[model samples]
Target chain A: MSHIIKPILYSYWRSSCSWRVRIALNLKEIPYDIKPVSLIKSGGEQHSNEFRDINPMEQVPAMHIDGVTLVESLSIMYYLEETRPQRPLLPPDFIKRAKVREICEVIASGIQPLQNLTVLIHVGEEKKNEWAKHWINRGFRAVEKLLSSSAGKYCVGDEITLADCCLIPQVFNARRFHVDLRPFPIILRIDRELENHPCFRSAHPSNQPDCPPEAIK
Target chain B: MSHIIKPILYSYWRSSCSWRVRIALNLKEIPYDIKPVSLIKSGGEQHSNEFRDINPMEQVPAMHIDGVTLVESLSIMYYLEETRPQRPLLPPDFIKRAKVREICEVIASGIQPLQNLTVLIHVGEEKKNEWAKHWINRGFRAVEKLLSSSAGKYCVGDEITLADCCLIPQVFNARRFHVDLRPFPIILRIDRELENHPCFRSAHPSNQPDCPPEAIK
Candidate 1:
């Protein structure tokens, strides 16, 4: 909150993890620059020596902010919340805050990693879709149940918390991979409401500077 | 750190996630009762409606603390740190704290999910070991590099931080799945140092009340 230099985000257009970071920056009204690290081009630019130096994990949504480079999407979000506390991503009440995080972890660790690009490559072309659908549906089943008890126009109450940052991108991934959405009415309602919100709309993959012509939706 | 009720932790003996929660509780010196939710036995206790009511995700490492149940291992740890600030699990400086979280996220989102029980079940019997080994090795490559830069007596310098909570369990999982540790000298070094530490030693699965006889390592 004290720096004059703009933050630099190493992100890829289609990455769900990168999308979470984009949503956070937008919601907090932080000014930043995006340094696209193509996860698919040139044998995955994230694997290049230059990018690896920035993020050894070769993952997207790494940020150069607060005078240091931070990797991992969740960690970046936490740093932003800790340092820039004006527009709080977590609710003020301790219980509500934990509820928000429960949903975030449901998507961040439980859902996204299983259907990730690296896992898809490992599962091979023959089983990737099946693998992706199984994990997404399993994760969504849990998300739906969690939301059933917590929802008040959003994933957890009416506030646009950090959980929404994880949920929208994951739902996007779920639909892209052809997972059935009809089974999850609560998730759909939240996703639809957020789709029209300015913060989430600006962070949507299609609106990003690096979004490919073919990916426009 | 005000409380009169004893917390309840729903955990499974060998779950790396359960292990992470156990360590945090011990490190913070918070007294909590363990309610074992066997991942095996009758097609997994986590899938039961009773457990689902407790944690919609139906995963182990759900905690009943601060008058509400919290799921997701990382979220539980965060709650513990926020509520019980004494003997902090994270460093005081913002940058150092981010480093600790970066390492934790590497294991939580990057490593642990790919080798989870549900993922192994889907990968099938024949390829399960191969799948586990491949992901662990890949994750360790990044973890080792990060530890080499930031580690001292522990994963993030001499102080015990949240990163150690993730690293010790992940290394336990890596060894259980037969992922060789020879290549990761820094990880192995930290693992060895923590092995004798009281917090980690007491939290080992074999030391848990519900650990089965065959799993007594």
Candidate 2:
């Protein structure tokens, strides 16, 4: 077994995607130090030379575990699951594992990337928020269908798998964009259930170390 | 093992992302039928009511395997890996599997979504190709750095993994967009090697059932 050293998570408070990882880390009871990377101020601190050295993509939620540095929230979460293994986030069976991963992929690949702040910037300021709402709503609708088939109290058969970790953050972003949740009853139910979980509530954007007061207001 | 029924892949010939799954299916020796969903002509068949029934997102490359339906290329690929374990596309060890998935995510999540045709449509026609080239180059550069640390004969190790499956299609798209590949030597080398492989060549857009004559020109 690898030595238990507290991992360091480099993240931004308002980044709902980063909030997902924080919840995951807490759920696994894995202690980690936080290094908040301000995404909005100074034209994105993640773009700085030093931060880019840690993550070439210059994205937040980069994790340093043991001696190795990991980038991408999904990758970091998977690594923790593998290295830790006690509190398993993925199912044991291969088929179930694939299903869990599928739900996660739908959010991580199909949804989150399109609605990211950087991509919104490229879409132009006038339509940025609208673009975010459009993609987030589109993604949530599809997620609603998948949840209709696969979800059970959580994204995949009731356990707090990696899919849930990916889902809550996206829902948070959706609400921020003012997407109507009435259309997605399944997603709303899942999000409501997840919100009450201690790990998830503690890691909410409003509770983060770097969350801006104005944004909350 | 379950009965080996012929799989059906609903995809478009020119869709670079769909082409990734095509290569994987071929590499795994899985025989399947190709059902074309033309992205052009009458503003995309993917948006039609019929296709939307199969895929709520109305996206290409949705697979029908052994009576189960799967969407998202990464998810479908993982499903294939699970159902057909003989030809493993992922490493056996946990960390190695996570690394291969990380590389795949960087392309699938980070690169491919940004330059998707739908996203480009919003950017306007004149800037569409430019948008594709910029994001492809950005993604390729990141792949170059990742491959520098992890690659050998392939993206992860000597054998072909999911990372290689993703790289070939993205490289093809980059070349199509006229993004200079000379700067990414390692990525180019890997592409050259995979390009020569029978599975990849067979799955090339030019060889698909619905490939347009002009695509080869």
Which pairs of residues collide in candidate 1?
none
Per-residue alpha-carbon lDDT of model 1 for A94-147, expressed as tens digits? 778888988888898999999989789878999899989998998999999889
Off by over 4 Å in 1: none
Q: Write the per-residue lDDT of candidate 2 for residues A1-217, one digit (tens) a residue.
A: 3446778899898786688789889889888889999998899998899998887777887888767777778888888887788778998876667768777877887888888888878778998888888888787877888778888888888788888988998888888889989999988898888888999988888777788888674
For residues B101-194, write the lDDT of model 2, one tens digit per residue: 8789899888988888877887789989988887788777778887888899999988899999999888888877899999999998998888
TM-score to native of every candidate shown: 0.97, 0.95
Using lDDT as the measure, the top candidate is 1
lDDT of each: 0.89, 0.84
Score candidate 2 by TM-score against the native: 0.95
lDDT, model 1, position A192: 91
lDDT tens digits, residue span B1-217, model 1: 5377889999898999999989999999989899999898999999899998998787898988867778899888988888889899999988789899899888998989999997798789999999899889989999998887799999888998989999999998898899889999999988888898898999999999999889786
Candidate 2's interface RMSD, please? 1.7
Candidate closest to the true structure, highest TM-score? 1
Clashing pairs counted in every model: 0, 0
